[model samples]
Target: MWVVAQAPPETPVGPEFGKASPVGLFILVVLGVVILGIGYAFHRRLSRFNRRRLFAEQHGIDPFDREAIDAAMEEAGLRDLSRTSYL
Candidate 1:
């Protein structure tokens, strides 16, 4: 039969105990490292996408600007929307 004991007042840990078990500490460290690695990978991917979007918005003509696109279509001799299937 398991016997229940009353709690001690002075900190649950006794003076004899120096540190946590080695295996427990090792597991905690490994978990922390894995979490950090995953966070870094996600950060890098987001940064790359942000950079590409910024460059496109600055240098490339806005695809949403219908007037500009129409002007370009006229210049390329593709003014007819019905004939230009690529558009």
Candidate 2:
């Protein structure tokens, strides 16, 4: 009597394995960290702006009045508004 053994069928690989290599995973983590840092900085800045706006509003002052800012800057002899740029 002779006995034969049969092999099982193989499974196909998926696409996710190809897209996410070790280097790609590292890059994605680094990019996420940088984006998080930038978002935190922007949030802090916005919070400060909101606080200032609220204070101005409480004092019956118009926060968007550029003339008032320019005049204050002129009185203080600080950086000129014409040469300064916002981030």
Candidate 3:
């Protein structure tokens, strides 16, 4: 009588198998910085728009009229410059 021998199952085992590469960490850090930059830009734009809206409301300029609002804001800027003494 003869007996058959079966080989053991193949499985991965090593120090490098589950480790993350440096490139992956670099990409993650770059992505985070890019997201933060976009958020900052968006925040600046929204803040400027908010200032425009408040200015229009205070001076009774029609908020929807872009040209009028811009003209008024420009005049206001000149008026502010004239009133304030810069050293």
Q: TM-score, each model?
A: 0.46, 0.52, 0.73
The superposed Cα distance between candidate 3 and the true structure at residue 40, in angstroms, equals 0.3
* Count of backbone collisions within predicted model 3: 0
Q: What TM-score number comes out for model 1?
A: 0.46
Question: Judged by lDDT relative to the true structure, which candidate is superior, 1 or 2?
Answer: 2
Clashing pairs in 2: none
lDDT of 3: 0.74
- The C-alpha stretches of model 1 lying farther than 4 A from their native spots are 1-19, 61-87
Of candidate 1, the 10-residue stretch with the lowest lDDT total is 78-87
Candidate order by lDDT, highest to lowest? 3, 2, 1
Q: Write the per-residue lDDT of candidate 1 for residues 1-87, one digit (tens) a residue.
A: 998896776755677667778899899999999899889876766665454445436657574665655565566565333232321
Q: Give the root-mean-square deviation of each candidate in angstroms.
A: 13.4, 10.0, 10.2
lDDT of 2 by residue, 1-87 (tens): 997876657645687644656898899999999999889877866775675566556656688875775565566565453443344
Candidate 1: residue 23 Cα off by (Å): 1.1
The 10-residue segment with the lowest total lDDT in model 3: 78-87
Model 3 reaches what TM-score against the true structure? 0.73
